[model samples]
Target: MFAALPAGASGSFGLHPQDGPHVDVRIAITDDQVTLSLTMNLVFLDELIPQRREQADLIDPPESSQTIAALLEYFASEQPLLVDGEIVEPRIEALYIDDPSPELMPLFPRTGMRGLRKIRFELIYPLSSPPDRVQFTWNSYPMSELTGGPLVIKAELTAEGILDIVEFTEQERGYTWHRTGQDIQSRMLQVPEPVVQQEDSSLLSTISIIVMAVGAIVLIAMLVSGRPAEALATLILMVILVPLFYLVGRPGNTPPTKEEARTIFDSLHANVYRSFDYVDESDIYDALSLSVDDELLEQMYATIFRGLIMQEEGGAVSRVTRLTPLNFDLENVGMLSRPTGPGLPEREALGFNVLYTWQVEGTVTHWGHSHSRTNNYTARYGVIATEQGWRISQMQPLEQDRVDDDPEFTLDEDIEL
Candidate 1:
C-alpha cells in the first residue's frame, strides 16, 4: 500500500534517531530559474513510496516511472515553493537511483537497511526574472514508526554569489532566501560612544593669578607702610581664593566600577567580532573604529579575519552567530597614556586590563555545505577611555580551543546534478 505523507507531517518521537534517514535539500537560483534537488537514502525512499520495497531490481526497476510520478505528485502537493510571494510549482527535471558511496555507507548502514541505493530528485521552478525573494516550506517528514524520530533535512541555498545553509526540522520547516546584497545573518553591534568629561582650567587659572598678584601687591604695600593688620587680612583672603580656584579647576575623572568595566569590555569585545560582518574593507574598518583603537584597528582586522577563515573549506570566512562570555576577570585598572591630538603631548586616562574567557559559535557555508564550530578562547584585553569613548587598546590571545565542529551536507560533492 502506497500512501503519500500529508502536508506538514511530523513525528511525535522525541529525538532524532542515530543513523536514521536524512534528507539533503539543495537550492540554486539563477537569472531565470530556481533549481532544487533532494537526495535521500533507499530506506527513506521506501518509507515514502512503499512500492519500492517490493521491487526486485532497485536500480532499473520496471515501475520506476510510476515511483517517480508518485514522488512528483507528493512533492507538488506537500512542498510549496514561493517566488516573490507567489506559490510556484516545481517541475521534475530528473530522478534516479544510485549506489551509496563508501563514505555515505555509514549514514545508511547495510544492517537493517532495505537497500544500499540512494534516490535523488532534481527539480526546477521557473522565474520570469531574477526573484527578489524565494521561500520553500518542507512539509514531509518521515513517520515515527519508520525512522523512530522526526526527519532532519540539511538545506543549502546558493544565490547571487552567496551561499547559506539552514537546518530544517518539524519545528523549523520554512526557509526564505533574499536577494539583498548583504549577508543575512551578519549584523553590526551598536556600541555607544564613550562619554568624556571635559575640563577647562584657563579661566580659573587666569582669575587666580590676577587675584594673587593684586593681593601680593596690596600686602607688600601694606607691609611697607607698616600696616601689619591689613597685610595679614590680605594674606588670608589670598589663601582662601587660591584653594577655591584649585578645587574648581580639577576635573572629575572617576574610573569605572568593576561591573561597569565588564559591561564596557563586553560591548567592545562583541563589536570586534561583529566588525567582520561588512564586506568592504573600509566598512569593516569603520565598524572596528567604534570599539577598537585606531592604532590597533588594521592589525586587529587582519588577525581576526585570518582567524575566521576556514582553511578546510577553501578559505571560506565564517560568520559569528553567538558569543558567550564564560569568565570575566577585571585584572587591573590604572592610567592609560594616549595622545591628546596630532603633534600634541600624550596624556594619561583611565584604563583597565581584563582577562576573560569566551566561546564563539560560527558557521561557514561553502560549496552547498555548512560547517559549524564552537571555539573557546581565553585572552587579555586592554580597554581604555578615549575621546571617542572606551575602546579596546590591546588584545593578547592566551588560549584557544575548538570545542565542537559539525559539518552538514546538502549534497555529495562528487555527485553532480
Candidate 2:
C-alpha cells in the first residue's frame, strides 16, 4: 500500500499522512474467545475525519487523541461481526496511531510505501465456540460516508492454528467456517465482484511484515539458545519490534516438523533466560513449562536456574553480561545431542545438547569488590511431543566449568550462568 502525504503533514513526532487507503485485519481465535487487530491507513481516515468533524465537534486535528478516539468509536459501531447468529460487541483493548515507515520499509513490495500513517486498534470478544460464519466489512464509514465512493482496501485475516487464511478486498465480505463429524470446511461465502482497483501489490509486504513480527517475538529464544548469529541476522533486516504475543508462536499447536520443534524450543529456552536474565525468578517455571512437562519443570527449577539465582552472599551485587559480540566465534558453541533421528519417533521425545562459553563481570559481597569470570557450560535438554506442541520434559548438565583469571581475586563461590 503506497501513499504519500502532503508537505508539512508528517508531524514532528513521526506521523505521516499518506494518500493510499489500506486496511489490514488480523484475527486470532481460540475455543472460547476471539482477538482481532485492525491497521487502517490514515489517508482514508484523513478524508473521512473532516466529514465526521463537520457532523460533530469532537475532532480537533488529524493526529490528536480526540480525533483517534472519535474515529475508533465510529469504527466500533460500524464493525460487522457475528457470533452464533448474534451481533457481538468487541471490547477495545488498545487504540493508537503510529508511523509505518520503520516497519514497512524492510518489507518487500516497498512500492515506495513510506511516509504513511497507521491507526492500530485491538478488540477482544468472548465466544462460547468458534463462529460458524462471519460477516466482515472492511471499512464501512469510509466506504459509505466518505467523499470518495469506495476506497480501496486490503483485508487479511489469520486464524490461530487453523490452516484457512482470508485475504481479499472489501467486496468479498462474507466468510464461513464449520466442522461436521471429522471434517472441517472453510470458504468465502460469495464470489467477489470485479472493481477498478489497484492490483494486489502487497504480497511481499504482507510476508515481510509477518516474518518481522514473528522474528521480533522469538528473537529472545534464539539468543538464549546461544544462536545470536541467527538473531543478529534478523535484527539487521529490521528494527526489533514486540508485537502482540498471541499472533506468533501458536503455543497450543503441535510441531509437525523438526524445524518447528526447534523454533518452539528456542522460544521456551529464550524465555527461561529472559526470566532469569531480568531477575524475574517467578516466571522461570512458567517459561520452562512451554517445552517440558510438570516433572521436568519442577526438576529444572529446583536443580538448575533456581540454584543460580540464590548465589548472592550479602550487600549490593551487580552483574552485567554482554550478549552481542561483534567478533563472535560461532564454532565455540556446539550442539552435543540433537534429537534428529528415528529414536525420536519411538520414544516420543527429542533431546538436545548445547555448549556455551561466555564471560561475566560483577561485584559480590564476599569479594568486597568487582571481578570478572569466564563461564563454560555443557547442558542437555529433552522435550516430549504432546497434544499441545512440544514441551521441555527433561534437563541435565553434561558438564560445567568456570575460570576466574584475576590473581588478586580468590574464586570460592559457585557461579550460575
Candidate 3:
C-alpha cells in the first residue's frame, strides 16, 4: 500500500500550446512526494517562404545598374543576415512560464521578461520546486513583412540529476516491494556474511551482557516477589498508582447489581503473594476486603493478624504461615497442603499433607503433628453479606499461639470420616 495519495493531482505529462510555442511537461505525485519525466518541450517555431515579385522597368528607372551592384557588393562584405533576429524578424510577441507557485517569480532575480525587437514575454514562474505545476504559452503574432519565413525551435530538460533521492536499504525497501500504510509484519533485514563474521566475537559479548541482564531481572523479581505486600504498599504510596488501580478495579463492579467474584480474585493476585508461601499485612486486607460483614469480618481479619507476633521460646527457629483467600469457587473449594520449605527435612521419611475440602465426604486430615493435640479450624469462619460486599466472618480459633493446646476435635455432623 502506498502511503497516501494527494488529492486531485496531475499525473499525465501534457502540453497546452499557445500561439507562439508549445510546452509539454510531465510530473506525478506519490505519497506526497514528487516524480518528473525526461522529455519536456519548452519552445516551438515555424518556417515558410513567400512568392517572388518582379519590379517594373520604369519605376523612375531603378537606381543605376552600377550603383545597385556596388550597394549589393557592400552588403556582401558586411555580416550575412540569418533573418532570425529583428533584421527580417516580425514584432516580438509575448513570453510565458508554465505553472507558477511559492512566490518564486517575485523573489527571483532571473524571473523576468525576455524581449527581442518585436516580442515581449512574462516569466510567470521562477525557480520553483516539485509540487509546483509548470506551464507556458506561445506568442500568436504572424508577421510576414519582415522575414519570409517564421521561426522554428526545439528544446529539452533533465529530471534525474534534479531529484537526487537516496536508495532505500533492504529493510526499508519494503516501502517499495509491499503496499505501504498497511499493517504487516515487519520484514527482517539480512546481514551480509562478511559483517556477521566480523561481529562474531562481539555477538558473544552481547550474549553475555543479555544473560547478565536477565539474571539481574530474575534476582530482582525474586526479591520483590518475596514481599508482595511491601511492593503493593510502595506502589500505593505513589501519587497516581492507587488511583489508577482503583479506576481499573472499580469499573467492573458498578452496582445496580454488581457481580464481582472474578474481580475479587484479580484483586487478590494483584495484592497478595510473596511467592508460594508467606502472607503480608496488605495481603491480609486484600483478603479482608472480600469480607461481607463490617463487624464480624473485621474481627476475623484482626484475629489472623497481631502486632504481638508469636515468638519462639528461646528465639527458636520455626516457620509461620498465615493465609486468607479472596476469591474461591465454593464448589471447587478444597485444600491440599504440604510442608514446602525449610525445617522440613529434605530426606525426612515422613512428610505432611492435609485435606480441607467440603466437596466430598470421607475426606480427613492426613497427618497430625507429633504432639497429641490438633486444631479443627471450622469455627473460625463463616460467610456473610454487608454493605461493602460478601466476606468471611466470625472466625473462632481455639487458641492463638501454640500447636500443643489445639484440640483434636472432629466434625460432629459425621457424614463420613
Candidate 2 stretches with Cα past 4 Å from truth are 1-18, 47-73, 99-115, 128-130, 139-152, 168-170, 179-417
lDDT of 1 by residue, 278-391 (tens): 556777787788888887787789878877887765666787767777788999888876534478787676888899887777787432235677777888888888767788
Q: What is the TM-score of candidate 3?
A: 0.18
**Which whole-number lDDT from 0 to 100 does residue 158 have in model 1?**
65
Worst 10 residues of 1 by lDDT: 408-417
lDDT for 377 (candidate 3): 27
**Best of the candidates, TM-score:** 1
Q: Candidate 3 on 263-340: residue-level lDDT in tens?
A: 332222222111111234443344444432334434544543331222222221112222222123322221212212
Name model 1 segments beyond 4 Å from true.
Answer: 1-20, 26-77, 89-135, 143-147, 154-167, 175-186, 200-255, 275-289, 294-322, 334-350, 361-375, 385-389, 401-417
Cα lDDT of candidate 2 equals 0.44
